[model samples]
Target chain A: MLKKRIIPCLDIKNGRTVKGVNFIDIRDAGDPIELAKKYMQEGADELVFLDITATIEKRKTLAELVEKIAKEINIPFTVGGGINSIEDVSLIIKAGADKVSINSSAVKRPELISEIASQFGSQCVVVAIDTKFENNDWFVYVNGGKVPTLLKTIDWAIKAETLGAGEILLTSMNNDGTKNGFALDITRKICQAVNIPVIASGGAGKKEHFKDVFTQTIASGALAASIFHFGEIPIPELKNYLKTQNIPVR
Target chain B: MIAIIKYNAGNTKSVENAIRRIGFNSIVTDDISTIVAAKKVIFPGVGEASSAMSYLKKYQLDEVIRSLKQPVLGICLGQQLMCKHSEEGNTDCLGIFNTKVRLFPPKEIVPQMGWNNLQGMKGDLFKGICDEDNVYFVHSYYAELSEETSAACDYILPFSAAMQKNNFYATQFHPEKSASVGEKILKNFLEL
Candidate 1:
């Protein structure tokens, strides 16, 4: 049976791991390669490294950091942040990343999704959607959640699947860094709307939040940053907790 | 020395890294001589079927691979292309295995990504690996079960998780990216 994945997302800035509340006011976490190795030892199913400073700084995701992580860790990992072109995806994948996530670039050019999927296969292309519920509807935000777009969250997810995204990393801006819980409603809606796998991100404060997202929504994975980075929740203990709750975790 | 067959596929680097982690040296190359002369050949791939097959054919790697006598392992797309046919590009494959690859029904998630357990293990490749041990997978098309199936995994349906026949072995999952369980399997392959 396919088990629910517990993913630790490392938000990378200037070669260092950092976590921010609400995608702002970022704080230093630790070294990325060390944290990645620790997560692998702790039984993380997968890892996601978002180059949070790539887009804003007009620099590509640190390929050196990606290669280091790839060399040190054995599990599957995705590299995201400033990936905007086929060449960008090529660099990261060549550096040993299993997948690459795109947000602003994909939104700016929807065809970019199909281009990367066609060039590197859809399975390696992860479409990350940062969303916020406002005025009773969820809107897609891009540029690391600094800019809002006209695309509705659900609509964008469905369209991304059509454009050949193999997975959706749905992060609720409203719940991000809140440590409350996941945005179950939007996560469920997007999961229902897309045939590809959806990873519920943001607002993961406790192990129960992982349970809530997996049981309440059809999310294939639950991703968190601060909780895992700060040792607030160790992955092995969390997996054990999930297993007892009848959630098939690995 | 080990040779990792490379031809227009993704994730070869990760495979090489994994080999290094397991304390073995490997070269990522498409050269026929290098692959033929290696003690073991790791045929790792992550890409579309038809294009990958064409690249293999372009360099006559299809024939070289079929002629290999040493232990040869195929991963993900490598496994699918080793089959007789694939519904992905409606393309004919290497025919190393007599199974057909089909797209999963849309009744569930298409890719079936993340960690999934393997069952019915019966080959040297799974020597120390336990039944129901989880391994990482990321693929939309799967090869059907056949006489060569050494292990199985269920997603939308029961499919070939690992298949073996003589010197040729294949897996629908990415063992290099499957962490410790995968490391054990790779170590087993290297030992064999």
Candidate 2:
């Protein structure tokens, strides 16, 4: 049995956390290392640092920041955003990142996943899918929800697993900042299609939403940003609630 | 010098860095002579039991580890494999501790990964550590708490958080990732 993980994602740009209201009105949260340390102390099962910048110059800065945080924190962490090549994955893994998550590059170059999986094992590779429900059909959105891929959400997740992704991180753009709950149907459908663990990202308001998602959806973990950032729901309290609900948490 | 027995474990470098942070030089190795000659040995691993045990046998480390006269420390999978037997590979362990490694059960979480409470610590490893200190753990299998258990954590069942039997000591958590509480535990092992 694997426990349901509670993760706090920190979207980084210019060495600061950019928080948005509904993913807009960006505000400075703090340094990536400091915020990550705070979350780890607060019982974050894992941390995700999304380098919001994709430009050539920003890449090095993101790697430096990742190295700083990785050196500072002791828990497992994943680095995403602008991870386009196998070299990037290898560099981050060597820099002490427990896992490297690929999004747009994985969708564009499907072979990269298997190449990485074959070399570094699937357990170290994670495929993060940003999805937006457009015209009643779920379309895979890439480039941080700026570009849309041709694959459907469910189909893309199944393909990712076949491509040797150990974990699937599904983020619902439509429900991302809604603070309602997870896309339970989408989570369940994706979980049923793929045997790999699925991490449900986006759309969490209260602590009870975690319980609802874990029970209604087949999700293995829940990831949130604003809710955890603003201290709306601390992780330990959330885990305590889930524990009372008979949901396994760590 | 602190020597970390590394036969392809993921967390060895992290442990090395942690020791360095405390002003100590450590070596990560699988060499029996180097380990046997060291004043202290730390067995660190983050892999499945079958493959790890295979590495031990492939390198003939099982016999070397059993015959170690100096203090030996095991972490996470290292601790589980120090027990009598493991269901991970249906393999026989070094039996340094009178315990058995078993799956976490299907109904419960398989890999109990994250920070959890450690209680009832009673060795030099907990010298400056307190009860309920959160230590980072990641594994699908765990060692059952027997008389050798020094500390315990509760998930689906009360499992061994730390174990001590003579010079053989083990912990189901990564003290390297455990912040100040864990740093102290590692320091205690070094001083022991």
Candidate 3:
């Protein structure tokens, strides 16, 4: 059986983790590599490092950080944020990232998904969609959720799969940081609309929220940042809780 | 020394890193001599079947891999290419293992990704690894179960998780990315 994955996303800026990760025992809270190793130890099925770094010049720093994390961590990890071209994807993959996630660049050029998918197999290409329920319709947002697009969230997700994305990282802007729960309706709709796996991101506050997403929707994975970082919900305990709920997790 | 075959496939760097983590030195190369002379040869890949097979033939790595006497392990697409044929590109494979690769039915997810458990294990490669231990996998096509199948996994259908025949061993999952369970499998291969 394929287990539901528990992923902890690390937001990076200038090669250092951006979000305040409140791990008590962690020596350097900013060191992405250290935080990555800790997540792997805590039974995180996979990790996502979203490079929130601003300047294009410092892209090399993310690659270096990826290489460092790859050497130390054995599980799969994906690198995203600011990846706009084949060269950026190549640099990260060659640096040992298992996959690369693309957002605005892909929206700007839908062919970018096909390009990366062709160069490196589709399995290495992750299409991240930032969506918010607006005007009684789910709208796809770009530029880190600042710019709204005409594309509907479900339509964009289906389009991305057709363009050769192996996975969909669906983050609900409305549910993000709310701690209410996942946007189950949109998530289930997208999961039903696409053959590829859908990872439900944002709004993960407690263990039950994880349970609600997995049981309520066909989400293959659940991703949260502060909850895992601040020790609000330890991964091992969550996995155990899911197992009891009859949700297979790893 | 270990030689990880380098071609047009992805994940060679990760395999090399995994080897280094286990306290062994390996070189990522397509040189026939280096692969032939190494104590172990790892054919790790993540790519399409036909293009990968053509690249292997273009560099004559196919023949070199087919004739390797030392313990040789294939990962993911590496395992698929070792089979006799693949439905992916309707391409003929290395024929090291007498099996056929078929695409999973669209009744379920096309590319079954993430961690899945292995069963019916029987080989030196599975030493110390328990049955139903999960390993990471990401592939759309799978090799059919055969006499060479050392381990099996079920998702959509029962397929070869790991296969072995003489010096050639293959795994449909990425052992390098499978964390501790994978580390144990790689350690077993290195020890063998």
Q: Give the number of the best model, judged by TM-score.
A: 3
Chain A TM-score, each candidate: 0.93, 0.93, 0.99
Candidate 2 docking: what grade? acceptable
TM-scores for every candidate against the unseen true structure: 0.96, 0.78, 0.99
Among residues 3 or more apart in sequence or in different chains, the pairs in candidate 2 whose N, CA or C atoms overlap within 3 Å are A1-B109, A1-B110, A2-B110
Residue pair clashes in candidate 1: none
Candidate 2: deviation at residue A187, Å? 2.8
- Candidate 2 chain A lDDT trough over 10 residues, lowest sum: A20-29
Q: Estimate, for each residue in A106-177, the C-alpha lDDT of model 2 and write its tens digit.
A: 999989899887666566678999998888888899877988878999999889888878788999998999
Query: What is the full ranking by lDDT, best candidate first?
Result: 3, 1, 2
Chain B fold agreement for model 3, TM-score: 0.98
1 against 3, candidate with superior TM-score: 3
Name every residue pair that clashes in candidate 3: none
* lDDT of model 1, residue B16: 92
Model 1 local distance difference test score: 0.89
